[model samples]
Each structure stands twice: as structure tokens, then as C-alpha cells.
Target: MITIAKPGLLTSVQDLGRYGYQKFGVITSGVMDPVAHRVANLLVGNDEKEATLELTLLGPDMEFSEDTLISICGGNLSPTIDGKSVKLWRSVWVKAGSRLRFGGCKTGCRAYLAVAGGFEVPEVMNSKSTYIRAGIGGFNGKALQNEDELEIGTPSELSANISKILADQIEDKKFAEMQWTISSEFTVSSASKPDVRVMKGRQYDWFTTDSQMKLFTEPFEVTSQSDRMGYRLKGPELSLEEEQEMLSEAVSFGTIQVPSEGNPIVLLADRQTTGGYPKIGQIATVDLSIMAQLKPGDTVQFVEVSHKVAQQLYLDREKKIHQLKQGISLKIRK
Candidate 1:
């Protein structure tokens, strides 16, 4: 068990997401950076779909009641155990009674912390992810706060073995980390502005040619109004060639919708099921992780890519993740 001493800006439990209920107007609330979430889980020998703590700009201060194995990935919130700095993206064995805390952000906007065993949260609609607005899942259907205690699920066989190996290395230290890490190539740098790639949306041609060109050329800053729901960009005001009323349609993650105001709103993990805005572009799946790392005031430029190429990029990324899992499994066997 772990107890929250201080709840940072916004901390919550999230898995991959909730699905199959969108038709009922349910939103899919999940981790913003799936790459980090998945990798963190893999490091701790947990399934990628297992629930993890998604720490926002800030993080939580907590105490572990029992020996625990953990991994931190995504944005660098600068986590420490018992005042000693710990490494991210690597598995670490933490002693019982250790105080885990995070400092000011150094890089990305959010981070994912995964334990040997996933968080034991009640599942809602077959998902443990929290959608706070509807209060559906996660720990009591809301963000974590002070005095909150979270129970850990039973560790898997692989997690037990990994824990045993790490514990032996810790010796007298509060925690110990593995020697190797996932290649940095698989990660997007939070310090750098990312060029998000997109494909033509279903309503791509509805916008004027000038608006379309401006989208790919002009830089857009993520407004402070942005949240898990969607990012409201501040840049050129895009207008359609002719004003026409359209029926609401399904909108997916990374859908770039332009409203009457002309500013583009990029739908995210917690976006509405459907939208009436004109969607001029759809961010590529391969670049969604990069977009997720972006924070308010961050500038981004869009680059167009063919859907075929985007699909290939996604395939390559999946292959890389598969290889990473195999390598980690071999290490555990050894």
C-alpha cells in the first residue's frame, strides 16, 4: 500500500483508456502519453494496460508501506526516494517506509509511475481509467489527494523475480536501479518543440486553401485553456470556403477541429465522443505521443504526411516496443 501525503497539481490513476461506450456519449479518459505509460509498465513487469499514476505538471508525495518495485517515465518531474534522486525509465527496488516525492518540472508536462503490480482500482465499464467529470472509474472516480491510500495488485511471477533481483542489489540503500534503460531514440525530448505530423481530415477540403496552408506553416501556441479534453491553439483564424451547417460526427484523438472562431482545437484523450466543428487535419498516430508531451504555451508546427507513411511509422514503432519487451523479458530470465 502507498499513502499520498501531498497531491500535486493534478494526479490521477489512468490506464490505456475506456472503450466500447462512446456511442453512449462516454469519453475515453486515459494517459496522455501512452508511450511512457506502456514503457513504465513494461519496466515493472506489468501489462501495458494496467493502471498507473499519471502525474501532471506537478506530482504527489507518498510513502510506501511495503517493499515495492517502481518505474517512472514520460515528463521529468524529478522524482526522489527518501530525498535521494532516482532514475526514470529504469526499474528500481524501493524499500518499505520510503518517502517518494517529486520536484519542479524539468521537461514534459506529465509522467507515469508504474509499480511491480498495478494499482488495484475498481473497474468501470471494463476500464480502471478515471474520467473525473463523469466520476466513472479509478480511485473513487477522482484525482488523488492527501491521506489517500492505494492498494497494489498481486505481483505477477515476472514481477516477483525482478523484485528479488533488484532487492539484492539495493543492499543498505533505500533503492537501487538497473544498469540499462530503454533507448532514448524511442522517446521524444520534452525540451524541444516537436513537429507534429498530420493527415487530411474527413472535412479537410472544407477550409479555404489559405487556411490549409497556414495550418502546416504557421506556428500555433497551446493556449492555457488546454486540458485533457483538448488543446485550443492560438494562431491563424481558419475559415471555411463557405458557411454550411453540418451534423455532428465522431471525433477521434488528435482530431483538429476548427470552430467559428477559427482557432484549431486538437482533441485529446478525454475529448467528447462527437463534434460539429470542421476537422481540417488528423494528427498521425505515430506523432500523438509527441503531441501529448506538449504543454501550454508550447509552440508546434504541423507537417503533412501521407496516411500510408503514417501507418508504416506506426508499424515501426510497434516493432520497437515489441523488441524492448523481449529484451526485458530475457534479462529477467537471465
Candidate 2:
């Protein structure tokens, strides 16, 4: 169990996302950065889909009520246990009663915290994600606050074994992180403006040729109004070839829809099930992690890629993750 001492800005629980209910108009709420979320779980011997605490631009302060095995990934928010800095992308064994805290942001816009056993949050619609707007799922269906206590779920055999090994190295009386860690080379560092790869959307041709060129050339700034729902981007106005009435259609994560206002809205994890806006592009699965790291005021340029190349890039990423998963399991077994 753990108790929150300070709830930072917009901290919530998430997994991969809720599925099979989008036809019912349910919003898909989940971690903005899938790579970070998955890697954190893998480091702690949890299944990739297990729920993790998704920390936004800011994080939370909590005290552990029991010995815990955990890992932090993605954004670097300067996490410390008992005032000592902890390393990102590594496994950590924290002593019971220790206080964990965080400071200002360092890189990226979000981070993920995964424990050996997932958070003991109630699952709604088969997912533990917290959709705060609808007030469903996650620790009592809302963001964590000061004084809130969260129960830890039972750890798997692998998780227990890993913790048992780390326990022997805990001479500091508070916490100790493993020496080796996942390489940071694979992660997207949000230190500068990034170019996101995208494929033309199904409704791509509906936009004027100049607007299409502008998408790949003009830099777009993420607006402050953005959230998990969508990124409201500011750039050269995208105009349609001509006004045409269209029925509401299904929208997917990373759908870049150009509304009548000319600005594009890139739908994300919390996007609505259907939209009537014309989609000019779809972010490639490979670059979604890059897009997820973007924060308000960050600038981004779009790069066009063929769907075939995008699929290959996704395959390569999956292959790498598969290899890493096997490597971790083997290391733990030894």
C-alpha cells in the first residue's frame, strides 16, 4: 500500500487502453506514451498491459506502506526516494515506510510508474484506466490526491523473485535501484522540436494541394488548450478543396483532423469515437511515441511516409520489444 502526500498536476492511472467499447461511444483513456508504459512494466516483471501510474508534466509524492518493486520510465521528473535520486529505466526496490518524491520536469511530457504487481484500482469496461471526465475506473474513478491511499496487487512469482534478489542489496535503509538498465537510446528525447512521421489519411485528397504541402512543410505549435483528448495545433491554416457535407465517421488515435477553423486537431488517447472533421493525416505508429512526448508550446513538423514503410517500422519496433522482453525474462531467471 502507498499514501499520497502531494498529488502533482494531472496524475492518473492507465494501461494500454480500453477496447471493444468504442462502438458504445466510450473514450479510450490510457498512457500517452505506450513505449514508456510498456518498458516500465517489463522492467518490474509485470505484463505490458498492467495498469501504471501515468504522471503528466508534474508528478506526485507518496509514501510506501510496504516493501515495493517498481520502475519509472519516459519523462525524467527527478524522482527521489528519501531525498536520494533514483535512476530512470531501472528496477528499484523500495523499503517500507520510505517517502518517494519528485521535482521539476527534465525531458518529455509524461512518465510511467509500474510496480511488480499492478495498482489495485478497480477495472471498469475491462480496463483500469481513469477517464476523469466521465468519472470511471482507476483509484475510485479519479485522479490521485493528497492523503489518498492505494493498495498494491499481489506480485507474480517472477516479480517476487526479482524483489527477493534486490532485497539483499538494500543497505541504504531506504531504496536501491539496479545497476543495469534499459538503454535510453531507443527513447524519444523531447529536448528539441521533433519531426513526426505520418501517412496521408483516408480523406487526404479532400484538402487543397497547398494545405497538404503546408502540413509537411510548416511547423505547428502545440496549443495550451491541448490535453489527453487532442492536441490543438497552430500553424498555416489548412483549407479544404471545397465545402462538402459528410457524415460522422470513426476516428482513431493519431488522426489529424482539419476542422472548418483551418487549424488541425491531432486526436489522441482520449479522443471521441467518431468525428466529422476532415482528417488530413494519420501519425505513423512508429512515431506515436514521439508525438506523445510533445508538450504545450513545443513545435513539430510533419514528414510524409508511405503506409507500407510505416508498417515495416512498426514491425521493427515490435521485434525489438520482443527481444527486450525475452532478455529481461532470461536475466530474471538467472
Deviation from truth (RMSD, Å), model 1: 0.9
Q: Which stretches of candidate 2 lie over 4 Å from their true place?
A: none
* Worst ten in a row by lDDT for model 1: 185-194
- Screening candidate 1 with a backbone cut-off below 3 angstroms (N, C-alpha, C), the clashing residue pairs are none
Colliding pairs, model 2: none
C-alpha lDDT values of all predictions: 0.92, 0.91
The digit string of per-residue lDDT tens for model 2 on 1-334 reads 9899999998899999999999999988998899999999998889999999999888899999999999999988889998999989989999999998988888888889999899998889999999998999998889999899988899988888789879999986799878788766556575587889999998899999999999999899999989999999999999999998768999988999988999999999999999998899999987888888899999998999999999999999999998989988898889
Q: Taking the tens digit of each residue's C-alpha lDDT, what string does model 1 give over 1-334? A: 9999999999999999999999999998998889999999999999989999999988899999999999999989999998899998999999999999999888888999999889998999999999999987999999998999999999988899889888889879999898888899666586455799999988889999999899899989999999999999999889999998879999998999999989999999999999998899999987888888888989998999988998999999999999999999999999
Error of 1 at 303 (Å): 0.6
The alpha-carbon RMSD values of the candidates against the true structure, listed in the order shown, are 0.9, 1.1
Models 1 onward score TM values of 0.98, 0.97
- Per model, how many backbone clashes are there? 0, 0
What local lDDT does model 1 show for residue 324?
93
